[model samples]
Target: MSHFIKQNDPSDLFFPGGLFLNSDTFPTSFFSLFPSSSSSSKASTVSCFSWGPTSRTKVVSVFSVIGGGGGGDFLSLSLSFNSRSNEDHQKHGRESRENVEQHEKKKVCEEEEKENNNVGLVSHGSGAINMTKHLWAGAVAAMVSRTFVAPLERLKLEYIVRGEQRNLFELIQAIATSQGLKGFWKGNFVNILRTAPFKAINFYAYDTYRNKLTRMMGNEESTNFERFVAGAAAGITATLLCLPMDTIRTVMVAPGGEALGGIVGALRHVIKTEGFFSLYKGLVPSIISMAPSGAVFYGVYDILKTAYLHSPEGMKRIEHMKEEDQGLNALEQLELGPFRTLLYGAIAGCCSEAATYPFEVIRRQLQMQVSTTRMNAMATCVKIVEQGGVPALYAGLTPSLLQVLPSAAISYLVYEFMKIVLKVESS
Candidate 1:
């Protein structure tokens, strides 16, 4: 059999071995990139391959003819093969790579989410621990400071209740002569028991209120008014909860008050003789005094502390103290300086005491009287005014100031110092 080669127009060409071809050589390049095995091609030489483009893909085709001829008679076979376009293959490869990349990104995001959850748990635990520490420090500081001034507190209570205006020296002499040194700390245990929980609640509640208000306002710093209101609210809450303990302490410490053994005895005696409500005898007056007193005290203290911390003189003093201590940081130096902190604390205490002094007198009278003899806060005020004039309301002012100034100073100093120490130790 002889084979004839032909050129089809100018665009088609002929090749050896009865193969007809075209000018477009892309199919040859595609075959070069993805060569089929000779064995596979021979085994499947049915010579018909069909393919088409899809919406997601594109197709390329190759065509050839094989023939044998004798004289004018001829036998011919045509073969066609389809392959994917390069652009379609590239597009599929890109999609596969993108899917893998997205999976890896999802894994990374899940890990980050787990880490954030752990951090949040840690932060919540740390905050709870800090609040507990703050409350403990405040309670301890109040107890220590109150104990330190227990004698002065007893003397002041006597002066107010007995309507005595004796000089401090005469008062001391009288107490010593009549009841000896033991008289100075007669009701100290009750005072401590009362003060510990009172101060704890006061400090913790104040902090809670301040934090909530700060978040509500979306501010890092609280205004003076906000501070005042928070302090008042804290005081009112504490007083209401601790009224029984306060009333018992007042009754036990008042001049010529009957001996009730101890805190338990005092409580029992009031309950048995006066009724349960009697334990809260002066609650109204106490709240009236304490709310404003707490507002003044905290407001003044915070304002002064902030002012001092930012002041040129205060900074110089802190720097000097830091230089002397050498081991202390700026914050430690500020907290450790007893004199300056005490001075501000005393000022705050004195201001608060002055504003609320008359209410103290009224509260004491109410606590001392029996239930039947008890008068309303307004009536008590009128009686005191009529009996001893307006000045009578300030009968114990001198000793009260003397007692509170140092008590407040020492309490604040101890609280701040303890807080710093606790923080450092915890860290």
Candidate 2:
């Protein structure tokens, strides 16, 4: 780090003019001729006359200066045609290269800043090292997010299963009336246990596939179409891996009084009661929903990051820095600017969630309905609509929207921070 301070001294002003000027062009006697307070106190003037052996043109120059008060001496710096030659051109090239190298070195100094500029698709393998680091970071973040929402997730399951509309307050009241205050979080422990690892697998697989597919298409940089495909792949992979867990959580969260002892118990109960395929009742809708939902979530984030980096203000900020000091590409810039990235991610997730809420409603109902019913996701959706109108398919939309905004934002923000931390620690 370099600290630069301004020096205040009259002599400092003379250093540049003396070093560059020729004695013939600006003689010592000229300084004496400069206007003092006694000569001129009102204004400054300049008159130029040239005369010498090379006097193709003779010019005489005169300048007036006002002393005291606020006015002070002014120094002029300019490069005339005579000053620039082949030698200067060569010098300029050397200086430019030095600046480039300096910029590269400075960027290396701030590894964290560099990390912030990185924008990785859920897909696209940067390299083995980054792949592992990103995967672990995403997995850990997913677990944290899921853990926090376990109780609400359980309540959502119950509400969906009962086919009822209940606001948060009423929902809490209902839970307390039937199962005590603890009932509000009836299956939360199991929900967390189920979703934490479940979400890890979900995000990991989604990103992995998304990256690979885009790479195959020669779009590892990932276009909008590519992002949609990548998000969809990741979502589907994750949804598949965790389908069984999804079923278990739904049942446990349902209004039923049966307290399945553990994950093993829950699985056993579902299989024994409703047959093996029952565990995947909502699989189709979930798979269908995951693709677009995931695509939109990540795609919107990328677009936001891209827009932020390209903005006028963003460009000015980068311009002020030494190119090497500002070690961020468009994507990397947003990572550095986490709040902007977060806003993008939040908006994207909310939009995705809202768009697919109908599918979500069907998936929830299929998973929670439990017995004597082999309802396909499509059939479930149709039934909900026919019975309770379109809004039935978006029963818990308020809560869903509420949960998504912050959860998605925090996940992305923390992910970016973690990347910075990892880069610093590793370096």
Candidate 3:
């Protein structure tokens, strides 16, 4: 990284990002971090604070900016890092660890008090509270992820419904030209209308399904595959409950859909003209696609979490966490933290989106049709392929991909943080 910058002449000094300095002469010496080892008998040694947050300021090594060789080594730079001695690290870690003796005593006392006070009911109460927390977590996570990626989402829908052959920028340009900048957020109200309920149900249902399936299997805990099944079930549940809004949102941005009017008008128009069943025109494809989509997305995240918990590095990460069972299970008790959660969610999202994208494309096409005669999933696939080759099946995929990474990552991160903040139950 440092090797790329070059200096033109002795009079000119170069910095990164195209910054240049003109100088007739350069300072031969600057104040020393460590006094000249050769010039003085007693050289100053580096010292650092080793207390609390201010700890770890030690200097590993220092190089003089201007060496004794002078002009031969112009602007010589030094690299140094702060590190703690093994003993200091050990001492800090020990002091920071919970007092096991005191913790055990407190636990015993609390358990005795609970037993005497009929606190067994508290478990059920806490579970109910946890459910509420889960709903809050899911709602916020959904709203944030949806709003953050609204533009890309609208663009993706436009590409799908318009069947445009334009690239990402070109599609965005077309929307901007036609409807101006706000077109990028077309139907976002309907989108959000669906999202809160959709994700709240999706997240809560995943947990409920996971627990039931785990118990049905006669297990104390859930496997990653079980998590996958539970997630699929959850997706189907959310889709069924909130799919109407999704359909309305799709048409509002599609070509010729403005006739249907705003969200309420579009919904009423569909029901009045095509019948109530028309609200779910693409239900079949939606369910089929969501199975794999939800499974891969939610399943991969849980799998990553489980894998991390079992890894050596992950074990080290959790050492800082309180040992009490504050989460609902082994999986919940362990965490991957914010950054890791985001990263894993992104990977999961990519896999889910890529795997089920064709179904999504088909589903969107089906949703837009107001005609009595409509194409089935298989027929729609055939039509899309016939129009623009196999690649056409992935027409809006670029914007979808662009939207999903941060969408999934932030969704999971925020959801997890909310769960913590809201004091959701542990195992």
Candidate 4:
């Protein structure tokens, strides 16, 4: 909220023969140099020195100068010290209390500064309030993006779970013919419930991990490798934490699993038939796929964003904004407009899905397995290969990309928009 403006002044002040002062010692009588303001027009000098050598403390000087006393213009100076005799121990307890209070106040001020240094994980310093904003932004982003891609998401899940038999057009025709337009989002409510927390955790975990890494490496800015590592760790943590919701969502959206009802009904069915642990059905494949999937997803976005920001095109955009006075600092210049943010995110999501589609298929298939038909990650991969050859491992990749591209784009767009709305700055 504060801005700088340079001022030009012709007034000046100077000292002749150099005014030298020593920290180790000071004369007790500063008033001897000049008479009182009422007696003469000569300026008076005041000096206040605080000494703390005995406690291994640094001496500090704090003073204020006020010219003009009554009618004449004069400089007033006062010098005083608080060195009490050791024998005067009566006020020792009060002094100790005052010292403690001063120390505590100073500490509080420092902590406040540290807390507000930046905005959440995007800032140089993060606090709980900032992190909460990140969580909220992430949740909103996930929900919005997933909702926009619900139809494609359902179609993609069907292709992954039911094996590759029909082409995209044929599948669309079948869904329309059998279930009508509404069928495209049959379990979208459940999807939202599952996705919101997953993304919230994903984004929060990424920020937390990246912040820690930044500090550990003592880097002024996060590198692409650090972003990848943080994204991967975030994926692992999020997938593991939200396994139950994820498992239920996978089943609820798959072909015959629609009969399982809503979230509560699905929960009871899975728990009763497959035991409680069934909730975490495909954790192994989830972690494996998600780790790299997340790495590419976040890393690509960050790398591309950095590249664009430094590119002539991006620099031009920033410069334009700066000339218009819309940009305030270097950090503000890093933020891309809505279209660019979406484009970068779309690219990142597409690359991530394309690179990790096989693992995703395996993970989803493993999630489809129940207690009676359990399969490990390797076995699931082998089965898919046997069923439809190597290509089968990438079944639904087209729809997956379709779903993820806009989904990721919107996620980032919404996230950045939320940051603006929340008054939190982007990194």
In the range 1-427, model 4's lDDT, one tens digit per residue, is: 0011111221222123222222112342543454445443233444454544344222334333222222212232334433453323435656788999999999999888777654444443445567778788889999899989999997897788776478899999999999999888878888888889899889878878887898899998889889999999999999988889988887776666768777887899889988889998888888888999999998999898888889998899878877866535432433687778899999999998998888888888888887778888999899889978998888888898899999999998888777666665332
Query: Which residue pairs clash within candidate 4?
Result: 45-77, 46-77, 46-78
What TM-score goes with each of the models?
0.71, 0.61, 0.67, 0.69
lDDT of each: 0.77, 0.65, 0.77, 0.76
Q: Give lDDT for model 2.
A: 0.65
Q: Report the lDDT tens digits of candidate 1 across residue range 1-427.
A: 2334335454444445443433242343543433334532311122334443432343333332222231111123554332445566667778878999999999999999999999999988888888788888889889999999999998887788777777889989998999899889878888999998898788778777876887788987878888899889988999999889988888776644566776787888889999999988889889999999989988899888878767887788767776778677534665437787888889989999999999999988898888778788899999999999999899888889999999999888877777776662221
RMSD of 1: 9.0
Q: Write the per-residue lDDT of candidate 3 for residues 1-427, one digit (tens) a residue.
A: 2223234565556555333322234332433444656652222344333334534434444333323222223233343443555456567567656566678889999999889677668767877878888888899988999988999888777678876666778777777999898887777778888898899889898988988899899988789889999999999999999898888877677766788768888788788888988888899999999988999999998888888988998887677466645544433443786679889989999999999999998998898765766878899889889988999888878788989988998888888878777766542
Candidates 2 and 3 compared: the better one by TM-score is 3
> Which candidate leads in TM-score?
1
Instruction: Kindly indicate the candidate among 1 and 3 with the higher TM-score.
Output: 1
Which regions of candidate 3 are displaced past 4 Å? Answer: 1-128, 323-334
| Pairwise TM-score winner, candidates 2 and 4 | 4
Candidate 4 lDDT score at position 334: 35
Q: Residue 288 CA error for candidate 2 (Å)?
A: 1.2
Q: Could you tell which candidate, 1 or 2, scores higher by TM-score?
A: 1
Q: Which residue runs of candidate 4 sit more than 4 Å off their true CA positions?
A: 1-126, 319-334, 425-427
